[model samples]
Structures are given as structure tokens and as C-alpha cells.
Target: MKKKNVISVVVTVVAVIVAVYTLFPFYLVLMNSFKNANDIVASPVSFTGVNVTQWITNLSNVINNSNFNFWYAFGTSLAITVISLILLALFGSMAAWVICRNKTKWSTAIYMTFIASMIIPFQVVMLPLISTFRDVGEFIGVSMLQSIPGIVFAYCGFGGAMTVFILTGFIKNIPYELEEAANIDGCSPEGIFFRVIFPLLKPVITTVTILNGMWIWNDYLLPSLMLGQNGRVKTLPVAVQAFVGSYVKQWDLILSAALLAIVPMIIIFLFAQKQIMHGMVEGAIK
Candidate 1:
């Protein structure tokens, strides 16, 4: 009993220490966001010494001084993310259902293909992907590079593996009886999918949405590659990178930009947190 108690105590201490270590960087960024460059440089550790006016002034400087069009970029990012989520959730869940329900050789093969793609690093495929998109766009006589829709297409492809993986497990837990009932009630496969299974998959969908939303929101490489040098269609992550330059770096503006970039994601997660928690619970039970 004493040995077990000692082990438990040690584990608890380690967990708390790890948690604090992981969270400290975020806390530092949050607190320093309200400070000017001088205050941030002078007392990086002091959270309470921030001059609210200076913080506000720095923030305003970022807001007022930025050359990138805010509304346009913001709208582009928002549209891409939303469209990506819709495609991911709709197609991923449907594919997962078919894979779980059918369990045929083709389904297994296709599922394995998705899983294999997930293991392949994006860096390895980046060049080929870019070339492919360029060729396709050239053939179509429309430039896909630096286009918003192209970014959405990239996200949908990249996000599919994990989304399908999660949704597959969740779909397996749902009883087949529900589908039978729907069939008896004059429901076709399409009707059953939309009316019966779709509603039941809400928790899993919510989890996928939150997970994919966070990823697509923060993704820098995919957007950078697709958007090109102009940076006109830049997302927040790419926009924040512009603050760092060889001649002069504005740490204050960079930090403020970082903070602003994360605010929307934080708000989204907070609102969807309940659904995420419930999905996790359900997944655990399954």
C-alpha cells in the first residue's frame, strides 16, 4: 500500500509538472501580448507589470499599420475553413459508414490507402502535389496556385485520413438496427444516411470539426505553397511571419499578431468543447 501510494504521488507530481511546462509558453505569450516591446524585453517574466495603454498602443499599431487587407484575408480564411470542414465531415463520415458497414475487400483496401497516406509526410509529397495542381490549372486555363479554392481542396485531401479514421470508429459503435428501422420506414440509403445516421453522428462530427478547424486555421505550409509570393491571400499564420524581417523585427507586432490569430480558434474550441468532451466519452465507451 505504501509503495503504491508513493508511485501514485510521483506520477501526480510528474503530470502536474509536465502540464505547467506545456502551458507556460502559452501563458507567457498571452501576458506579453498586452505589453510593448520594451516591457516584453525588459521583464518577460512579469505578467502584472504591463502598461495597459502601451499594450493597447502596440495592438493599435498592429491593427492600423498592417498593409495586408484584413477583411479580405479574414473572409478568405473563414470560407476555406468552413468549406473544408463541410467536405471533410460530409464525405469522411459517409466513407466511414460504408467501410464499417460493408467491410468488403475493396473497403478494407481503400481504408488502408487512407491510413498509408497519413503516414507519408506532407513534405515528401509537397513537390508532387504542387506540380500536379499547377498542371491541372494550366490544362484548365486557370491558375490554381494562390487561389482560395485550391487551399480548400488541399485541406480536404490532407484532412481525410484522420477524419475518416475517427468517424469509422464512431460509426462502428452505432447499432445496425437503426439502419434497418429506417429502411422499414420507407427510407432509401440516401434518406437513411441523411435523416438517421447523420443525426446520430453529431458528436463525432463535432469532434472532427473542432479538430480539423484548429488544424486548417493554423496551417502555414499548405497555404504558403498554394498562395505564392504575393501573400495577398495569406492566412493569419503566414501574415504573422511577415512581422519578422532581416533588417528589423517587430516582436511586439509579431506577438500581437500571434495572439490575434489564436483568439478565433480559442473561441471556436470553447464553444464546441462540450461536444468534444461528449464525443471523447462516447469513443472511450466504444
Candidate 2:
């Protein structure tokens, strides 16, 4: 019993050490954000002499800067993340259901394609993606570059593979018996999906949304390419880069912007962390 207790103590100490190591960077960012450039340069890690007003001033600088346009960028990021998640969840579930119910060669082929696409690195297709979007935009008489719809469309395409992959696995575990019962009630295929299958997907869908939301919110490269660095429509990450350059590399404002950009995501995780874990476990079990 004493030996087991010693082992548990060692494990607990190691876990705590790892947690602190992981969180130290975030602590440093938050700590330094409130300090001025001179203070930060003097002692980056220390919280001494920090003031609430200084933090407010730093945040104000970031928010009011014409280049960062914090509010606008925040709104843009929120819209893109929310809209993309909605579309991905709806369409991914539908696609997964179709693939699960119809176990034909075509459906199997499409599912395999989605799984295969997930393995292809984004870097391989990024340039071609840009050129393709440009050509398609020109052909369709709508600007696909540096537009909200363009970014959202890109997100749906890029995020679709993983979303379908996760949802398909969950859908496969859902018994065919429920679907058959719905059919006997004169429910059309569409009605069966909307009324029965979708409702049951709540937990797994929440899991997918949180997973995708974090990625889409923090994503820099895809948006940076779709919307140019200095474009009018900027997400939080892109705007932070522009803001830093516009300020001549002022780290104080830069860190403040970073903090602002991450606050929403942190709040979301705090609220939904339970649901996210529960959904993931439930999906895995199914």
C-alpha cells in the first residue's frame, strides 16, 4: 500500500509539472500584455509594477487602431467560424448519413475519397487552391478572393473531410432500426434525417463544432491566402499581423491583440468543455 501511494504521488507531481509547462507560455503572454515595452524588456516574466489601467490602455490601442480594427476583425472571425460550423455540421451529417445508409460502390468510393483527402497536406494544394478560386471567381462574376463568402466556402471545403470522417463513424454506430421505424411512419428520406437522425446527433455534432471552431478561429494561413494580408475583410489572426506591422513591431500592443484574439476561444472552451469531452467519449464508445 505504501509503494502504491508513492507511485501515485510521483504521477501526480509529473502531471502537475506538465500542466504548468504547457500553461507557462499563456501565462507569460497574459503577464507581459499589461506591461509597456520598456517594462517588458526589463523583465518579461515578472508581474511586478503591472497596473490595470496599463492593461486597459494597451487593449485600447489594439482595439482602436485603424489597421487592426479589433471589433471588425472580431466580428469577421465570429461570423466565419459560426457560419462554417453550421454548414459543416448540417452538410457533414447529411453526407455521412447518405454514405452510411447507402452502402454502394459510389458511396463507398466518396467516403474513401474524403478519408484520402484528409491525408493530403494543405501546403500541397494551397497555391493551386488560390489560383482555382481566382479562375472560378472570374468565371462566375463574383470575387472569391478577399470576400466573406470566399473564406466561408474555403473553410467548408477544407473542414468537410474531417467533419464527415468523424460524423460518419458516429453515424455507422446508429442502428438501422431507428431509420426503418421512421420510414414506416410515412416519413420521407429527408424527413427521417431531419427529424430522427439529426436530433440524435446532438452530442457528436457539438464535439465536431468545438473541434472545428478552434481550428477555424485560430487558422492563419488559409485566410491569409484567401484574403490578402492588407485586405478589407480580415480575421482576428490576420488583423493581429497587420496590427503589429502597422505599429512598427510594438510587442505590447501585439501581445494585447493576441490576448484579445484568444479570449473568445477560451471563454467558449470553458463553457463547453464538459459537452466537448462528453461528446467525444460518447462518439468513441458508439
Candidate 3:
């Protein structure tokens, strides 16, 4: 009993330490956001100069600045993220179902291809991706380099592999008997998938949406590359960079913008975190 108690206490203490370490950066950002540049420069970690008026002033500066049009950026980010998640969830589940149901060498090869692509980092293909998109956009007579649809399309492609991977694992464990029964009932393949299979994917779909939402919302590199830093269309992450200058860095405005950008994702995670865990564990186990 004593040995178990000693180990449990040690584990709890370690977990608490890790939690604090991970959250310390966020704490600093939040704390410093409520202080002026002088107070932040004097002692960033200190709580002495924290005030609500400074907080409002900083946030107002970020919001009202022409460079950081918060509302427009927020809308662009929301549209791209929401549209991308919907498409990924729909197409990913459909592909996973088809792959899981088929028992051919081709299906296995395609699954392996997706898994292999996951190992390749985005940096490896980013430049190529840009040129390809530019050429294709010109060929097709549509602007793919600096558009919302272009970014959403890129997200779907980048996010597709992992979405299919997770859903495939979970689908593999779903009893084929359910699908077989639907087939015997004279349902079409499309009907079987949409009416039967897709409904059962809610929990896992929510998981991928949240996962992809956080990534797409917080992503800076892809958006920065596709949508130029000073582009008319900008996501929150891209717009936040406006506070930073070549020589003069606005720490107060930067942190305030960072705070605004993260608040939505934090609210979402707090609410759907349970679903995320449940879906992940179930997908892995089954």
C-alpha cells in the first residue's frame, strides 16, 4: 500500500509540473497583454503593472488598425476552416469506407500510399506546390495563388491523409455484417454509404474536424505562402503578423492579437475535448 501511494504521489506531482511548464508561455502572453510596452520591457513576468485599461487599449489598437482588420480576417479564417473541415470529413469517410470494404491489392496500395505521404513533410513540397498551383491556376483561368478557395483546397489535400488514416482504422473494426445486411436489403452502394455508414461516423468525424480545425486555423506557413503577407485576403494568423515590423516590433499589439486569435480555438477545445479523446481511443482500439 505504501509503495503504491508513493508512486501515485510522484506521478501526480510530475503531471502537475508538466502541465505548468506547458501552460507557462500562455500565462506570460496573457499577463503581458494587459501591460504597456514599458511595463512589459521592465519585467514581463511580473504582475505589478497588469491593468484592464491597458488590455482594452492594446486590443483596440489591434482591432482598429488597418493592417489588422480583425473582423475581415476572422471571417476569412472561419470560412476557410469550416469549408475545409466539411469537405475533408465527407470525402475522407467516403474514401476510408471504400478502401476498407475492398480487399484488393489496389486498395491496399492506395492505403499504403496515403500512409506514405503522411511521412513526407510539407516543407519538402511547398515550393513545388506553389509553382504547380500557379501554373494550374493560369491554365485554368482562375486565381489559385491568393484566394480563399485555393487555401481551402490546399488544406483538404494536406489534411486528407490523416483523416482517411484514422477513419480507416475505425471502419476496419466496424462489423461487415452491418454493411452486408444493408446490401441484402436492396440498398444501393451510395445509399449504403450515405444512409448507413456515414451516420455511424459522427464521433470520429467530430474528432477529425476538431483536429483539422485547430491545424488549419493556427497554420501560418501554408497561408503565408499562398496568401501573400500583405494580401487582401488574410487569415487571423497571417493578419497577426502585421503587428510585427522589420525593425520595430510591437510586443503589446502582437500579444493582444495572439490572445484574440487563440480564444476561439480554446473555447472549442474546452467544449469538445471529451469527444476528441473518446474518438481517438476508440479509433485506435478498434
Best by TM-score: 2
Q: At residue 168, what lDDT does model 3 achieve?
A: 94
Best by lDDT: 2
* Minimal lDDT window, size 10, model 1: 240-249
* TM-scores vs. true structure, each candidate: 0.82, 0.91, 0.88
Ranking 1 against 3 by TM-score, winner: 3
* lDDT computed for candidate 1: 0.80
Instruction: State the number of backbone clashes in model 2.
Output: 0
List the pairs of residues colliding in candidate 3: none
Pitting candidate 1 against candidate 2, the one with the higher TM-score is 2
Arranged by lDDT with the best first, the candidates are 2, 3, 1
Pairs in steric clash, model 1:
146-226
Runs of candidate 3 with Cα error greater than 4 angstroms are 1-18, 277-286
Model 2: pairs clashing at backbone N, Cα or C within 3 Å: none
